[model samples]
Target: MNATSGAPVNAPAELHDRPIGDLIRDARNLSAAEVEKVLSYQREHGVRFGEAAITLGLASPDDVLNALAQQFHYPLANAERRLASPELVTLLQPFSVQAEAIRAVRSQVTMRLGQGEAARQALAVISPASGDGKTYFAANLAVSLAQLGGRTLIIDADLRGPRQHEVFKVSNSAGLSTLLSGRAENQLIQTVEGVSGLFVLPCGPIPPNPLELIERPAFALLIRELSTKFDHVVIDTAAASLGADACVVAARCGAALVLTRKNENKISALQDLVASLAGSSAQLLGAVVNEF
Candidate 1:
């Protein structure tokens, strides 16, 4: 009949600063094995109930909501709505193999560029030819960077054949081309919904002279502008061996990720592309082995 004995358990404050395992242990009052199950659930669904509890330094749902509202300028009920939203939940999915590979490349590039210089602004993902999985790699890589808490922008620079929208299953109605033409810069820069810290500039309608658009001084200026707004601006460029577009984009990028497939032609093509870019100032950060 004791009130305290029958009361529900509450999470500890300052949970965010604590190790995830420790937070889980404290919150659920469970054994290590049981806590791991909850951790697994959080990773799969992108729902970090224990982590959120810690992040907001709260012991109960109401306290968490109140803390977020007070610190983040969000209304208490609105904060609760957002926290319970499925979109927010999905953002918590654990990193996949593809994300890890992309992270490896990002780390290599950052090391080569050195902390301040390399991490300065923009990064690009390209290949020697089509079907090398450049777009897929770029999309996953951008998501990876976002997961690491960096604001990322994935630019679809493949004007000849824009595929990023299709990869992310997002719209392509208004994008880079539209922005360039002075149509809708504001509208074209699409915020990737549900995925925090990630935005996309899809390649709108294909232009007849993609090379011309890429080479213009305005294009370089555009790159610079985008770089300022995001921690990492990853461009999915056309295959270098296919045309001059990728090279132009590469020149402006801080570094490029060269992708190669397992087949002999693709490997040989990648080598040739590297040789071609060797003369320029653009640095080939490293080659990614695709489908291997």
Candidate 2:
């Protein structure tokens, strides 16, 4: 007789709605060796008796595996496991220079952090004006932090015109705004696959008042929470002189990585930004002069 023809016909039906473990325990008459083989097959290909159960309208294999993975902190393979896009990886390779820059900045912050203080530090990347490699610097800095064995989180806080998700070719359907609105945390946060220890919180849908949103208590709380979770929190703020959002972020950030192109107009803007932040509490960690 077939496997199903021999069982108490309604037995599988009763266990159908039960948990996978319960179903496994109650489905008697199946030998221990046979049960182990079924389990092994399931683990290797995510199929076998579980799928048969579901196919026969008994239980859901997907849900069971998901629950078990979540309960055990099992690292499930996801889109992030795919290798970084060739073009994007090539573009970021030059950022090896930024790795050194970040080390220097990290030293300064470490000295300032002293003992007994929380290691929650924030860093912002700002430029004299647009198109000065600020985002590139920020992205590279994040990668650098991950390379150093730190859990790094990069936030595209440029609400006015966010680009982090686009640069990484990821979805921006949900992010900081969704989190601020009290949505599920997993929905807004995504781990950058392939790059171990690097996470990104894309600037979801841009709101009308980017400055107002950044200044909200929710924003501060989010930053604090994220800082605690990651070893490094790098925020890509808008150009310092071009938007109010940048200034607000600058005021809250522990340090600012100023970017200035090697040019007269940009240098002038950088000078102005330096003067503007000179008296402010935000530490001017250092500046990066981007060539072309």
- Give stretches of model 1 more than 4 Å off: 1-96
Error of 1 at 48 (Å): 14
Model 2 Cα lDDT, one tens digit per residue, 228-289 = 77778889987765676776687677667677876634556777887777766677766767
The lDDT leader among the candidates is: 1
* Prediction 1 TM-score vs. true: 0.67
Which candidate leads the pack in TM-score? 1
Find the 10 residues in a row with the least total lDDT in model 1: 85-94
Task: Flag regions of model 2 displaced more than 4 Å.
Answer: 1-119, 181-186
Instruction: Please state the error at residue 150 of candidate 2 in Å.
Output: 2.5
Score every model by TM-score. 0.67, 0.63
lDDT of 1 at 163: 88
Q: List the residue pairs that clash in candidate 1.
A: 15-54, 16-54, 46-92
TM accuracy, model 2: 0.63
Error of 2 at 233 (Å): 0.5
